[model samples]
Target: MIKKIIFTGGGSSGHVAVNLALIPHLLEQHWSVQYIGSEQGIERKLISGLEDVRYFSISTGKLRRYFDWNNFKDPFKVLKGISQAYRIIRKEKPDIIFSKGGFVSVPVVLAGWLNKVPVIIHESDITPGLANKISSIFATEICTTFPETTQYFRSKHTRYVGAIVRDELKDGEAAKGLTYCGFTRNKPIILIMGGSLGSKKINEMVWMNLEALLVHFQIVHICGKDQVNHSIHMHGYKQFEYINDELADVMAMADMVVSRAGSNSIFEFLTLRKPMLLIPLSKAVSRGDQILNAKSFKAQGFCEFLEEEELESERFVDMILGLYEKRSDYIINMKKMNADHSTSKLIDLIKVYT
Candidate 1:
């Protein structure tokens, strides 16, 4: 029996949310959980002051494939991070390490491999991130959100367990959540999320078309903490800096969602059976993955892809209005693609490795 577990990964909400999803299961099993992440990452802010979970800091940064001045500094930083992770692993002495694939997970995963601790990586995207790609060589098992991800990894240890979504998202009643988000009974709501830090392009496009959005549907815009300066006086628009623990409700109540094509965010929309309009980050060096994710959803008839460049104010307003007009069709497609209880399947697989 595993008495101690180390959860590593967290630079964005995508990586952090995986750990958050698995926590309840670990707690019920009476496992002591320790989290190792970068001090500079958003994980530090999200997991701060949480009880029962010990948090340790590591010096880490993203490994960009391109030439940058920061690349020169990475080798030393990675060395320091590895040493810090080694010390933490020695002290904590976890039976297994669970990594959710981010820059922070690299040090812990490497250290765990060297120390003979079993490392399991959960890749939450169709295309595995840089850390997961490298860590798969030493990982005992690789858990993926989509089956398509296995082709990217040479490890025969891969298994498709779907995305590990929070229990609240998995089992929570969508209707009640809609009510909590200030929606009236039977009114179709539209949810908007610009990703963890907020997408300036998405935010600007939504802001430009806010007047049109408020006409037919209730809007719950998760404006993200960085971009919450807009006035919230629309007839049916409610804005939040962050949703805290009520994301399930917001998702459940929404008839359709407008969001970025981040894997985690897309999975949430898929699991909730909410039709989506995905605007992937155009500036990313690896831009094709999200576009592919959006394409898959679109091909499956669950969501529509609206490229960032095509998201002019008039175009966005017309597209949303068109979706609202075809609401029933969108709902049917979303329900068809819903895969809600994926976390339990993921935990069951992890138990085998444990």
Candidate 2:
């Protein structure tokens, strides 16, 4: 009999990336694939592009740590989601469930546990997010991107499988990337990405230093949805809301990267051997997970980092230049890492549990 798997995750693209990386491989292996996500989430949009995958939407609520007016209504939505997920699990009867943790996943995991189906959770951050922390109780096993993350779980068996990067991302052509961006090979390219939704601070900082930055290097800025400035059309500076089909090529041509320290993005850059200067989200905005990821990468010499709290006008250009100067060292350190087998190892782990 052919094995089947149900995957769940949403909220942000980072939550869905691992599932995207795994789905193609599983499909090749003849495993039936399905996804459960929120009705209007980024995951739904991302997953819609893939063929052979059936998607089911559940009523999900934000699993917030702070109090909010919606918190009162969210519990009912979560309960409703659990019921919906339970029915889906009953009908699909998947051999296993894999979740990249987000609010949408909590209900799916609970439903999987209730259905007695094996469930695996992949936590990309150094620490478990709020949703994953709750889902751990129902998960058969938890996989982590950081080895240090294993210690966070008590009863669950946590495995550090490293980062799972998309295979297509590794095959980008620098020439195609340049052509796509209408940029010349005369100057080094700096790709600036501020997550999927964009960053106000990073955008403002780039705008402030645009003249100085353009003097030294060409730039490809993925400035998130509705954040692109049509008024500023300068030579050698390309601004995009997002790059879907040609993201690989764009990344291929980039000499260096300025980005948020999301685990998925940083690992892809590491796989491509792109020296990066990470500006992680501040503790004020997030739970400080990005800060931890950045710190870990800096400690391992894979990248340099600047905390959001410490972002200074004078040091922004200097730090980026300094990172470029020490690019060789970062590449050498990244080369020492053995992340090539992460996907395979994760697949093996899934099979073992199944």
Candidate 3:
């Protein structure tokens, strides 16, 4: 009999990439794949078009730490989601369930657990996210991205397996990237990314220093959806809301990366040996996971860190220049770093459980 697996995760790019890394392997092994996620989420958008993967959508409610007006209505949505997921699990009857934690995964996990299907979860940050923490009780195994995260999970099943890296990323062509932007090969390229939705502060800061940045480097800015400036037309500066098929090529041309420190994004850069200037989300906006990720990378010599507060200072451009000067060190450190992006460990567990 062919084995089957149901995958769940969503809400952010970080959560989505973990599941994606595993799907190709599962399919290669002839395991039938299914995905359960929110009806309207980034997960559905990311996971929908994959070959041989059947997607099931459920009504999920975001479980936020802070109080929101939706708090009153969210519980009902979550309960409904659980019921919907439970029915799907029963109908699909997959041999196992794999989840990378997000609010959507919580309901799917609980449903799979109650149905007695084996469930495994992966946590990609240095710390367990709130959704993962809540789902741990139902998970049979918890895979961690960082060694530091294992201690916090407190689960006998927790295993550290570094961040997942996509295989296609290794095929990026610098020439293809330059062709996309019509940029000169003489100037180094600086790629700036601020998550999927874009960061307002980073956008403002980049525009403010556009003249200074353009003089030193050609820039490819992935400024996120709806954040592009129509008025700014400058040579050697390419602004995109997002790029899919061309992303790998763009990455190949990037001499340095300026980005938010999400675990998925940073690990990809690390695997590519790209030196990065990390501007992590602050506690004011996030739970400080990005800050921790940035600090960890800095301590390991994989990247340089700048607090959001530091951007207001005139020295931000100088810091970027300084990071470029030390780029060799970052590449050397990252080259030595263990990269287990192939998902062999996670696949091993899946086979055992199934």
Residue by residue across 1-354, what tens digits does model 2's lDDT show?
899999999998899989999999999999999999999999999999998999999999998988899999999999999999999999999999999999999999999999999999999999889999999998899999988999998755778889999888999999999999999989889999999889989988898888888988999999998999889988889999988889999999999999999999999999999999999999998999999999999998999899888887779999988888888999999899875599999999888866
**Model 3 clashing residue pairs (backbone):** none
Clashing pairs in 1: 177-249
Query: How close is each model in CA RMSD to the real structure?
Result: 2.3, 1.1, 1.2
Question: lDDT per prediction?
Answer: 0.81, 0.93, 0.89
Clashes of 1: 1
Per-residue lDDT, model 3, residue 73, is 98
lDDT at 77 for candidate 1?
A: 92
Q: Which has the better TM-score: candidate 1, or candidate 2?
A: 2
1-354: candidate 1 lDDT, tens digit per residue: 658888988878888898888877888888888899998888877777468888999999678768899999887898999999998898788888999988889889999998899888998778887888888988999988888998888888888877766767756666777667766755578889888887777877777777777767778888887688565576677888788667776676777899988888887777777778888877554636778788888888777788876778887887787777776776787676545567787676666656
The full ranking of all candidates by lDDT, starting with the best, is 2, 3, 1
Q: On a 0 to 100 scale, what is the lDDT of residue 99 in model 2?
A: 97
Residue pairs whose backbone atoms clash in candidate 2: none
Q: What is the TM-score (0 to 1) of candidate 2?
A: 0.98
Minimal lDDT window, size 10, model 3: 337-346
> Which candidate number has the best TM-score?
2
Superposition TM-score, candidate 3 onto the true structure: 0.97
